[model samples]
Target: MSLAERLVRLPDPRRRRGVRHPFVAVLLIAASAVAAGARSYAAIGQWARSAPQQTLARLGARLLTSLNVRIAPSGSTIRRIVSTVCPGGLADLMGEAPTGAPAVAVDGKSARGSRTDTALAAHLLSAVTATGRVVSQLRVPDKTNEISTFTALLAPFDLTGTVVTADALHTQREHAKWLVEVKKAHYLLVVKCNQPNLHAAVRALPWQEVTARRYDRGRGHGRRETRSVRTLTVTGLGLDFPHVVQAVKILRHRTNVKSGKVTRQIVYAITDMTAREASPQFIGRIARSQWGIEAVHHVRDTTFAEDASQIRTGYGPENMATLRNLAINRLREHGHTSIAAGLREMSYEPFTRPLDLLGVAP
Candidate 1:
């Protein structure tokens, strides 16, 4: 189904009587506007009003006055419907990924714009694929945090044969067991000071004897970096972690090209993936792929200005975040590597361009 069709499947929370705008149209407009670089409700409403009559009709936008004179939903209408719509349902509708041994990175981010006196910024845990597809997301409830919400965020996914990677905060024994024993999936969890014994044990393993090792180097943005990863099969180490067949250590050496400044650090992780199931090179790739979640957040904050937005009331922040995710995924699907440029291009012709993103182009 098309993106519009997928959006229309969400249950509308608005009352029926005297409704001037269709909820689906409001959502579609908001999504398209965000995809086209409209950051706030006012910008979304402006984009909707500026859309061509033919484009609005193709998006199934309701007629506020007459068929001959097309009108778009105002900022309030868009914000109401968008904030009230279920974020999880929208994510399920848009987060359709193919089956494979995909590397899924689980991470959390806080919307700085949502901060208020009574509450802190909105914290959300998201599972993103290595290719930058958002598989699922859940808001970290008030009085709680990401560690408490990690398992629940992953419950809706079919994780069989997938390698799930997470930071040290989620490196709990129960989570590791659940991923391996219950979900039939593999896990590569980082070990840090949070789990002292595991970190020490993993760090103490004799990695030099391991035959499987990998090295990679890259240069970009005025920096040169080298990464080396070594994997060792842990046998009888008596570690408390469950189903850990191998441990890995990644050493990163980075230098500033201009300033000649150098920095080096070592990171550790334990995984159920055997040396045969995933070579050291593959493990290195999965380890590096964990940054994909950060990339998604970066786009939302910088390109979409999600952190600077002031729409924190009700479900507005969550709803806007979901729409932003859809926008990014849509652009990526269309082969746009640079989100800023894509948004700028769409911003130039908001009236006609959004139709293509809505899959309602004539």
Candidate 2:
């Protein structure tokens, strides 16, 4: 079946009037609002009312025979209908992933302004793919951590044959065990201060004692900076750690010029992959992927103006953030030459017209 047909087949809770056309209208409005950079209900209403009536005419072909195409839904009416449907139901309709995807990263972000006089700040956990699509998400109270929300967020999707990665905050023994033992998925987690013994042992490895050396250099600001990294892989270290197949030490030395003076800094990382499984190139790539969460957050905050959204109601902030994610993924899927260019094009006047530029019909 076609994309619209698959979408309409998904469950929606708001069936009060036995009219399906209005429901499809609301879905179309929501999709267009996200494409045009309307992140909240109010902005969506404004866009819907301001849109030319012809913009929705195509949806008539998709409606059931019993439903009339002449009927139009008011902004408030669409909002109420949309708000009544469960977020998970809507996400299912939007396509999480096709089969055979490799990895899914779980991370959390706090909506900086979504706090109330009586409620705690809103925190969200999103399961995003490696190519930067948010597959699914869940919201938790401010007092809880990502671990508290991980299982619930992961419950709805298939996890077999996929690798789950997260920052050190979620590198708990139980979390790792659950991903490996319960979910039957491999895990690549960052080791940090939270696991004191693992951190110390990985830090104390005989990196200096090993005989391996690698150096890389690049130019910036008309000056040259050189970095040297050495790796030492040790097995049978007599360290008891959970889900740790092998331990490694990475020593990085950087020399840069600041105000005509040179400076240096060192950093390290610990992983569950063995030296055999994780070559120098492999480790470097994985380390870089850790910043995927940062990229998602940066786009949401700056390009989408997420910080400026004043949605501070019950679950409103979290839900709007999810919409922003949906918008980002949809834009990425449509093959924008670059995300910045995509955002700039969407920010222009008559934003809806640019859908044709991206090969998407209204």
Candidate 3:
């Protein structure tokens, strides 16, 4: 379905009285404005005002029959709609993860600008696909952490046949069992010091004796890094962890091409899939998928200016983040790797090219 039609699914938080714009129109304008590089409500309002009458009409802008004039929703109205809309619904409507079998990465990010003296910044746990599309996100309530909100963040989607990848924070025995047994999905969870027994057991594996099963090198941004992955089957072993089929150890070495500095780090991960089901290289690749969400976080901050946004009223922060995700995901899907450049192309003089991305029929 078109994003405009999908937006109608968002719960209307406004009452019927004094509603100046169509619900879909208001949201469509907000989304279009953001896609055309509007960062905040003020920018959205300005973009709406400068928009052509026909553009507004196609975006569902209301027509004043008395004067035959089409006017955009006011900034305050847009702010109200954005701040009250359901974030989860918005994320899904903005091109969510495909249900078949893509690898999904779970991570959390904090909107630093939302922090106040009385309350901490809003931290959201997000599930992002391998291609950097944010499929699901939920706020971690004040005084709570992602670990507690993990299940709730993933509750909305059908994840069967999905390989869920996450850091050590989500390595709980119950979570693993739920993903494997209940959700009918697989988990590739990193092992860390937080889970002492699992961490020690993974560390004690005869990794030195097992040759590295996978090798890789990365060169970019003034540094070169090499990595190797070694896998060992531990299903028959008397491990305390749930449904452990393979234990993986990844060792990474980084050398600063400019400074001649070298650094090394190692990480271990456990997956429910047996070696036959998932090769050692596949395990390493899926484990690396966690960076997709990290890249999303970076793009939000650097490209979309998410960390700098001061929107903290109601659901404003999360809603704006979802809009940013929409912009980036749409551009990426259309083969625009440079989000900033794609947004520049979107902000054309006619202000109509970005509408094509929204599936607006000419």
In terms of TM-score, the best-performing candidate is 3
Instruction: State the TM-score for model 1.
Output: 0.95
Estimate, for each residue in 60-165, the C-alpha lDDT of model 3 and write its tens digit.
7999999999988889989999999887777767757658746999999999998888878999888888877778788888887898888887877799989999
Q: For residues 1-362, what per-residue lDDT tens digits would candidate 2 score against the true structure?
A: 43356557656656556664556556666666666777678777787666654565644323334864344466666566565556665665564662455677788887877766877667777777877778877777567777888888776777876767788788777777777778777667766777888778777887767655456666654456665555555546765555666544444433445555566655455445566666665555444455576788888887777777777765467656766776677678778735666756675843455344333355
> Pick by lDDT: which candidate is best?
3
Question: Cα miss at 32, model 3 (Å)?
Answer: 0.7
Off by over 4 Å in 3: none
RMSD of candidate 2 to the truth, in angstroms, is: 4.1
Ten residues in a row with the worst lDDT in model 1?
Answer: 92-101
Better of 1 and 2 by lDDT: 1
**All candidates' lDDT scores?**
0.83, 0.64, 0.86
Descending-TM-score candidate ranking: 3, 1, 2
lDDT of candidate 1 over 54-133, digit per residue (tens)? 87777678865654665778888887888888877877776746357478899999999999988888888888888887
Relative to the unseen true structure, what is the C-alpha lDDT of residue 314 in candidate 1, on a scale of 0 to 100? 82
Better of 1 and 2 by TM-score: 1
TM per prediction:
0.95, 0.80, 0.97
